[model samples]
Target: MKSAELNYPTQQQELLAIVHALAAFRMYYLDEPPIVETDHKSLEGLFTQKMANRRLARWYDILAEYQPTFPICPERRTASLMH
Candidate 1:
């Protein structure tokens, strides 16, 4: 899905993307801890953020179930691929 199509805030949008991708491929990665690679380094500290809203808190809880690992990748190196 396109980011423009999502009405959520930028941070929420990022989290939603991860959630959607994981849900769509749950069968293939459910049994194993999935490695989530992203150009957005902020995602690596997503759960550590002090969520001021319930929505973000809820999203954090949902993510806890997957036990995902976020590896920091330089955006410039992955810029073209992101497009």
Candidate 2:
């Protein structure tokens, strides 16, 4: 399943909401690790960089806590889904 959102000023908020939705899905259905597919490169970059604005930084920490060893693959400008 994929969640696609428009790139608006509230992009960060939208992404966080999507993350929560995915987490809920994981808890209710899939017990195994789930690879969340996102088109937002900044979202992936934020997690990969491991830093962000005050509020986003907190979420980043929480996300990092969940999957302590997830991989961050860099994608080319023309590629969809980094790597």
Candidate 3:
């Protein structure tokens, strides 16, 4: 990660990964609603509501095109999930 990107919070990185994946698999996402399964519970709210972080806000705009659904698994908790 570049120095400019090193300061992003955990949630921001998670969202970044999602954005990258969406862009990488644009063809597949274009046809159907992508399901993003993550342990980060906050991501649901991050995308659903307005984001304060400029970086996140930008990624949110990118995500709007995919119209993905975050069905965060109830079984896996963020604290317990290992990086």
Best by lDDT: 3
Could you give candidate 1's per-residue lDDT for residues 1-83 as a string of tens digits? 67563877676688888888887887887789889877776675666769878877877776787888888788787987758
lDDT tens digits by residue: candidate 2, 1-83: 22443343355765577567656765653445555554455665555564546767766665654553333345554285335
**Model 2 vs. true fold: TM:** 0.48
Q: lDDT, candidate 2, residue 60?
A: 65
For candidate 3, give the lDDT of residue 76: 47
Off by over 4 Å in 3: 75-83
Q: Return the TM-score for candidate 1, rounded to 2 decimals.
A: 0.78
**TM-scores, in order shown?**
0.78, 0.48, 0.77
Number of the top-ranking candidate, with TM-score as the measure: 1
Q: What would the C-alpha RMSD of candidate 1 be, to one decimal place?
A: 2.8
Where in model 1 is the C-alpha error above 4 Å? 1-5
Q: Write the per-residue lDDT of candidate 3 for residues 11-52, one digit (tens) a residue.
A: 887788788989999998767899988877887677667668
The local distance difference test score of model 2 is 0.55
Assess the local accuracy of residue 25 in candidate 3 as a C-alpha lDDT between 0 and 100: 90
Better of 1 and 3 by TM-score: 1
lDDT for position 22 in model 3: 90
